[model samples]
Target: MPHYKKTKIPLLWLRRHTSDREFMLISSVLVGLTAGMAAVILKTLVHYIHVLLAYGNRLLDQPYWLVVFPIIGILLTVFVVRVAFNGSIGRGTAGVLFSISQKSSMVERHKMYSHVVTSAFTAGFGGSAGLESPIVVTGSAIGSNYGRDYHLNYRDRTLLLAAGAAAGIAAVFNAPIAGVLFAIEVLLTDISISAFIPLIISAVVGALCSKLILQEEILFNIGQREFFAASHLPFYVLLGVLCGMMSVYYTRMALRVEELFEEYQSKVYSRAIVGGILLGLLIMLFPPLFGEGYDSIRLLEGNNAQEMLQNSWLAFFGTNEWLVLCFVGALALVKVFAATITIASGGNGGNFAPSMFVGASTGFFFSRLVNLLSFNNLPVSSFAMVGMAGILSGVMHAPLTAVFLIAEITGGYTLMIPLMIVAATSYAMVKYFEPYSLDTKKLAQKGQLLTHNKDRTILRIMKIQHLIETEFQPVSPEATLGELVEVIAHSRRNLFPVVTADRKLDGIILLENVREIMFKTEKYDLVKVRELMVKPPAIVQYDDSMADVMKKFDESGAWNLPVLRNETYQGFVSKSSIFTKYRKLLIKTTNVA
Candidate 1:
């Protein structure tokens, strides 16, 4: 039974008296707990599926079954998308980001339940995706549902949603700090000390639950890495540039593949069949492109069959043989193509894993090129990991998360400096390069700016005090027009603030009011300021954001407005003075107006 509707009379009384925020917090905890449990359960289920697939491959004496995992994954994805999700296609993290940036909301409350199930299944079935997106979506949706169910206001609802998203990331990644950072970095788009307290609480709860259920294990099993010498700093710098260029390539390729699949998937099963065929053919040469590429990274890093080619740049192309390079490169290109089609053709998935796969391969290839030139004292495997981290950081532009994730997974603090250098270089290289990742681009296309690191707060631009217009004589609401005219004649102000006998604001009366009265012969002497006062004028609290105030100014069409708080009337604000000061400051700072 729902909390409010328990089969007891006292429960209804308790629900009616308690504040809605308390209820949402209680419900959000439940959501986080449940989402954590779901993640654990789904992870176990996916592990079992992997084991079964591995056993089947051993029995059948064919490794192709592993390549076919994505195909099975996509099929199961289609069923969930079609049935459980009720045909709500494109329900992924990018979708959630697009929705939130554009609408200030995540999944609709009505669709929350279906979205969680479908997203969990998509990742669990080997969709070449990560669980972070699902965790974010599930947590955010749960928060939104809690807000709606408990009757919180819009602002509180938005906060709860962000809190839930943070919890989800914390639970799935087992990185509580990173989860909180992701919320502040990507979703909230602003930092506040007060907001952190509740969000931190939620994140701690989520992380603790995950730790209690599943013991701490680094997601990637990276062994001891040989550190690069200081002499190799210049070479790592070059790797940074390569990672940046490769990031742009991945973004372009992913979008192009999405467009191609969207245009070609009209015929039933065409995208699926073509994607399956391409993936099957590609795995023949470079079996590394299959799944999340975690195993591929391990194979390349460990004592594998392929040795680092020190004499050839062709190895940088992802294969040793010139003919094989062309084939493997073409196949790697096609794998990205198929992954894009998998999502565009109604498959529920995320681009995070695929982007990392491309990045890792790019880095691995770059390492070969660096080694080929007789570059000394550089660990090629470490370079590969840097490239992986760089590409993902560049595309996602969540550098801290990318860097920390790579450091944690690799179990190497020595790699942090190089990792940060490469990641920062990639991020800068992409500046105004592609308008902040593919997901942000979608938001832009939908007419939302969603720019990063903006100073849109009131404290950034608000002035201490400006032009209070004391020339404007305060008029009593009961004053006659003749007396107001005498008062106006002595003052140079175009607007006057009218107050009641108790000194509370009545309304603003403009010169246009007198002009309207002058047209009627009898009104000139008979009318009072009370009769002419504009009722229900716009009012603002002093601490409100200037952006919000500006929006209100636009909506209300008030050149001068009253300020109020706690039933007390403060001074008025003139839009002209604010704008004039703003213009001068912009000029002084040499900022674009």
Candidate 2:
């Protein structure tokens, strides 16, 4: 055999270092503890923001206060977004998902930092979005960054990311069980022995941190309640169906609002100004639209129908009860739209809590409608909560997370049966209508595959033939960087194949290397492919399965890899091409299925 350098991949490096199970366990616990602390800080900051926003809303009740508060809020938010920190948009859990799905554990550190700070400002200033997003972003980024700093392997890095996410949820809600469920359902998408220990520890530590600080002050303080009566089964089913429809409508409206904001970003404050005016007017007419909707839920739960009705959009319009129902339902749609616009226009906030608020409010309205139609005999509050769970879960596409979260928040296990019934039904219905959730849509945009099975091999979906770079331009290592740039500009390859004088594979020079050389100095004329070629480049045997090829590609973080046998290069594999072919195949397979 010819002399060969012992190339070490990051994945192999990790396995070699982590030889003992106990050491790994201890390391995971430490990771969990660290993640939990970070999550606590993140959650505490968002809560403070929420509190300040509440004060701002109260100020909106006064004319002088109204003008000053909005200005202050907007000014503070701008400082956070523009000067103090940028990249704060998508700062929360959704940001974490976006980062992990597209960039893996190598997220931009500034982006993560900016995300936390700006999200706090946005929420504090009364932006109508959720808080959980920032928490997740902060935790996951910290964990992932720690892994990066320690030079952990890909699998360990992914685990740390998951631990951060789980810890964030636990810290935010003080719900360890819910955190685990959310991690498995939303983040990990699988429960493995390797992942479970760290995630569980992280969640537990996070919950402990929250308990030590917040002392169980949940957003909604729903008192203990009896189980749903058998007589309410029909109503629960109806509520489930209604929630399903609402969930689909809510997701569609939110996405559309985001799209609208993106389309009109050039106008900047004009869209926000207009939205702010509308929100102000809506709040003046119906105070329920004032903030994040938790207070609205509290208002409804207090059963002060007279006060709610007195702000009489209901009575002035006609039948009081029916009119109240209409107003509440309309408000749900408005709030969802507002939340979407708030974040889309660079306001920067969360999504999960606001979604819950919208769902709860919708459920409350639907229950009233059901009661009104049924001689005022339906269990409106119960169905309201049930419907809220369903709609919220359906919209987020995180049924288990919503189910257990609502349960833990309410301190009511009796609601589980109804919650499950509504959650599953609503999720199914929404999925039938609108196939993509917010996270999934972002993944689709980035050309990433979002699959359900852990065992599923990417090769099964991707075709090998499609991944080959077939423009058929072979360059000798003696070729200058100027020539390489010309070739790159003229060709579609992001990577170039470096061949020796005999047209045999010598190494590979990626576009990134060329760009670095061009930017570092005006020495492109002096540089050659051989100078920039990365030695010990990933090589694959032609006989390897597609699965093996995929594993290599992921492990190497290369968009292209070489197929070689006995010093002979056969072809190259491009990740983008593989992905494209996979998408086509997916569409075909789905049609057949």
Highest lDDT model number:
2
Candidate 2: stretches off by over 4 Å: 1-24, 27-31, 34-39, 42-58, 63-75, 86-94, 215-219, 266-275, 302-323, 449-593
lDDT per residue as tens, model 1, 246-307: 77877788788777776765553566556655554444344554445566566555524153
Shift in Å, residue 522, candidate 2: 53
Clashing pairs in model 2, backbone N/Cα/C closer than 3 A: 92-133, 92-134, 93-133, 130-350
* Number of colliding residue pairs in each model: 0, 4
Q: After superposition, how far is residue 400 of candidate 1 from its true place, in Å?
A: 1.6
What is the lDDT of every predicted structure here?
A: 0.62, 0.65
Looking at model 1, residue 559 earns an lDDT score of: 80
TM-scores of the models, in the order given:
0.68, 0.71
Any residue pairs clashing in model 1, and if so which? none
